[model samples]
Structure formats: structure tokens, C-alpha cells
Target: MAEELLFTVDGPKAVPARRISLAEAGLLERQHLQQWVIDHPELIGNGVKIVTFEFDRWVSGAGSAAADRLDVLGIDRTGRLVVVELKRDRAPDTVTMQAINYAAMVRRFSLDTLADVHAAYLGGSTTADEALARLMEWAEGVSDETLSPPRIVLMASDFGPTVTNTALFLYEAGIDIRLLRYQLYETAAGEKMLSVAQLLPVPDAEEFMVRPRSSSATQAASRKSGERRAAAAQRLIAHELIPDGTSLTVTMPNLVGQDRDAIRAWLDAEPDRARVRWYNDLTAPVEWEHDGQRYRLIGLIRTIIESATGKPPQAQIWPTAWYCIDDGRTLNQIADPLP
Candidate 1:
């Protein structure tokens, strides 16, 4: 059972201390708890950010029909997807199976598709691509290819032995899942306190039970790639190329006949800048354009050398830098870190 806090009155003062719950407090309706967690995801656990709520996945076939919906979907800093299932009162015996099914469905989601779901959940405040970029940054460039399996989280006011045993069996069999129990308490002044606890695998058993699989060579390669991407993102942030809230338009002049050393020197002098890509005549840029304003630099040469010479741009002279930024949408979506 989760622990609760109790207050004692001492002459003109009240002191609070920890106290284990002897009996279950009044239950919070599932919808209320869902909304609360949606508003405050940290209540679910540390480093968790709710990506979308009430996600619906249609599962219909020619002869069979079923509607599949997830209560909440989240992702951690390492890009591991979290599938959260919530129950208000007692958790049913089949809850573990239900969460497993949801995890199976969610594990196949690509980065772009996850971003689309998040954008829709945000009511179209930002484009899917931009949201995805931010998520990647938060995930420290943990690439989709290297993302771990989806983690199943079962949250309920209470769990029966059957559900606990089932969860334990799955965990022992190498499924990444956890159970969190929520308990609510009321104070003399009618103030409410909520306590959450991780029940399955307990704290001490986590190290042995949740270690990553043995794929040393593959993991090393993936880590190297992730590090490179993370470094690039950090450089972009440091150089202010990717401003936090405002959109930017970066223009680079064509370096056809320009002095390579001088251009390199100029680029080096710029603070917080990193080389993102080198574009040649054959290299096609994304066709989409920024919506509001168009900024153009005067005397800028626009010829693609590859086009003129019928050859690719020389690696030494390629001159295009790419940076990403949000598009006017507010992202107060994640929980603030615990103090």
C-alpha cells in the first residue's frame, strides 16, 4: 500500500509526517483521476511526459469489429514509449492483459506517427514535424531505431493478488511493465493529499529485473549515432540557431566563386552555429515554406553549381545549414521536474 501524510496540531502549529495507510481512502472516479494525471503527469512518476490522452486506435476488419483506446500515452527522456492504463477502484484481473494488448499496438508507432498524435492532442498548435524535433531533443536524440520496447504502466487505486501475480509473471518473463497504486487522503481542514507507489518488482529488484538485453555490439553502434545527433542538437541550442519560442529564417549565400577560406572563417566566427548539411544541385530541400514572413538577403548568389557544371557540389564548397524551431505553439505539455 502507498504511504500517506498525517498532520498533528501543536499549540498554534501543524506538523506533517509520513503515515502508512491502514484503510483505503474514498475512491476518486476514473475520469477525475485521468484528468488529474493528464494535467499533472509527474504524479505518474519521475521524468514522465504525457504525449497524448485518450488515444484511440481503430481495430476493425471485414467481419470483426472492435474499438481500441488507450487512456494515456507518454514518453520518457530516453525515448522509451510508455503506455499507461488507469483504474479508479480495484484493478480487474484482466487489466494486465489489456495493457499488454495496448503495448503491442503502441510498439509499432513510428516517430512521425507519434508526433502526429501529439499534435492532434495539442489541438494543432504545432506541426507534427516540429513537435517531433522537440521530442527528439528531450529524448537526447535517442533514435527511433534504437528506442526500447514500449513500457506498460498500470495505475489503479488498488490491485488484487491475481493482477499482481500476473504482472510479476510478465516481468519475470522479460516484459517491461510496472504497477503504481494511488491513495488519497483528506486532512482536518478538508485538504486532500495523494500518494503514489510503485508496487511490482519493488525498488530493490529493479536493477536485476529491468536491465537492457545483451546486444553489446548493436547497442554500441546505436549509442555512437545517438551521441552524434545529441551533439548536433546541443550545438544548435547553444548557438541560438534554434530559438526557444520564435521562428527563424536562415539564409546562406551561394559560394560558387567565393574564397573558401574566408567563408569558413566567417562561419567559424559565428557563435552557436554548427554545420547541419551541405546542399548541392541534386540535393532537394523540403518544399514547404514558412507561413508568415519571407526574408531575403541582397546580392545573394542563387545558382546551384551542380546544375551549372552537371556535377555534384564539391564537398569543400557545399554551404547550407539547417536548424529547427517551434512554430508559435506553446508546449507547456510536460510536467515540471520535481524540486
Candidate 2:
């Protein structure tokens, strides 16, 4: 079974909002953006620090600068000079020719020309000498023979057929031209989000890279080899003993003698951790008279640890093992346990 309640209501239809014009929109002027860059002007890329943003007249040997509100000129930290032309809505009629003229102007800029531009742009804050020096430094790896070309950057919301065709043609003709598409997004809270929606140099998109595993592996191996070599050196020094009364002399067989001399000389220079022991392999019984007790090096190590720490070690502590002296055959055979 189904039951229903009825209600009647009348409402007026609402009209859709009209699209905003470019002027009505809160789009920032290209000059305003340039000023923003000049103020902060610290563009970073690939962990590199860039410190300058500048503009110059587009066509070389033809003008001082593009007429005001006509075109903008600039250089990035990479020492790459850029010419920017902005269209209010669709592509402007003269933008292609304008950008071409600007590129030509950039070609004429030499060290002196760049210095003049910097001084004009930065005002009394910079001297021509300092600006020229910086330009030379930036030009270190750049070839002096060829006329350094400039990159062309076009900013617009939409491109007309002629502008699009021109840009495409110039790009294929080996001109470094890029189109940046700017878009506006509005939030429900009446907030606007202006963003760079697309860029023409598609392959040069931002990316993140991590260190390769092989590099870490190589570093780890190097560290291990260093530790092993250090351990071997320390063990060689440990096998040597200083001679009695003779501060510069040591008692060691001339066979393993170099380390012994080194230790003896070091001790004479500085008596640190000083001790003396006869050279006897652990396999061969060593008899040492300590407090009328015949203690082997192994027995001495055990007794020292037991008395110092007041704890019984699990294994019978012994001196480090080496081959037997008698036959140099059976290695590290413990003689008889303490009877």
C-alpha cells in the first residue's frame, strides 16, 4: 500500500551570470608582474639560486625600448633574456611582429649594453662596472663566437588563428618560443585562483628525482673497506711490545718488526696505554710470573677481566690467536685447561 501528501508552490526562474570581461577580472598587468619579480627576484631551479629579473627593448639597433604598454623585456637567473608580450583577451594583431622585433633587440645587447640596461633599471643602486662584471661571470661557459639568441614568451588567455600559426611556425623554425595559458578559477566563497594552466615547453615540466641505489651501495662498500683496513693496522700495532728501560727500542722478532718499532717510537714520544709482553703464540704455552703465579697471556686476560668487572665471562677469555711457533702448524690449540 502507498500513501502520498500533496503541496503546491510557485517560484521565479533565476538568470545565469554573464561572463566577466578581462578588464573586469582581477588579472595582474605584465608590468605589475615584472615589478613583483624585481622586488623579490630570487628564482630557484635545480638547487641553483638565481638573483636577477630584467627587461630590454625587443628589436636590436632599432629602438631604446618598446613603446610603453606595448611590450616588456627581461632576463632570468640562468642569464637567459626573455621578451614578453601580453594580450588583454585574444592574441593582439601585432604580438608576433612585436616579439620578433624584441628578439632582434636582445641580440644587439653586449656587455656594455647590458650594463646600461641594468643601471637604468636598478637606478643608483648598481654601478655599470659591477653589472658588467656579473654579466661576464654569467658568460663564462657561453660561447663568444655565436650571437646568443633569446627565448620568446607569449602570455594570453586565447590565441587567434594567425597568432597560433605564427607561433607554431617560429617554433619549428628553431625559435625558442613558449606559450603560457593563464586561467581563472572562482571558489564558492567568492575567492579567485589564478593559475598557469599550461606551458608549451611540455617536456621541461617539473619533476622530482631521488639518489640512485648504486651510489649508496658504493658508499657503504667504501666505508666497510676502510673499517677493515683500520682494524688490520690496529691489530699489527697490538702485537708489538716496548723494550724495558730503552724508551726508543722495542723487543720484537725482526720478522714482524716494523710495527714494533713504530709502537716503541710512539711510546717514547707519548707513554699512552703502556705495557710489555713477550712474543709467544697462544698455541705455544707462555709462562709469566705474576705474584708467584705462572699465568699465560690467555690466563692473564681472563684474570684481568674477572677482577675488574666482578663478573664471570661466558667464554674462557684468551689472547688473540696466531699460528704455533714450534712448527707454525696447528693454529691456536689451547694447551691444558688450568689444573
> Using TM-score as the measure, which candidate wins?
1
- Cα RMSD to the true fold for all candidates: 13.4, 26.1
Candidate 2 stretches greater than 4 Å from native: 1-22, 26-70, 76-78, 134-147, 199-339
Candidate 1 lDDT over residue span 1-339, tens digit each: 434556767799987744323244443445578888888888777777788988885454464545787999988755678899998767998999899988877877877778788778777567775466456545543455534478789998788777876776566556767888877666665566777878875744333333344445543554453342222223333344422334322333343343444444444554322122212111121122322212111101112223234433332221222222234211111101111
Please give the distance, in angstroms, between residue 117's alpha carbon in candidate 1 and its true position after superposition.
Answer: 0.3
Q: Estimate the overall C-alpha local distance difference test score of candidate 1.
A: 0.56
Clashing pairs in 1: 239-272
Lowest lDDT block of 10, candidate 1: 330-339
Tens-digit per-residue lDDT, 18-107, candidate 2: 333346665555554444334433311121112234453444235454553424555542345556665556668578887887677667
Distance from true location, Cα of 51 in model 1, Å: 0.9
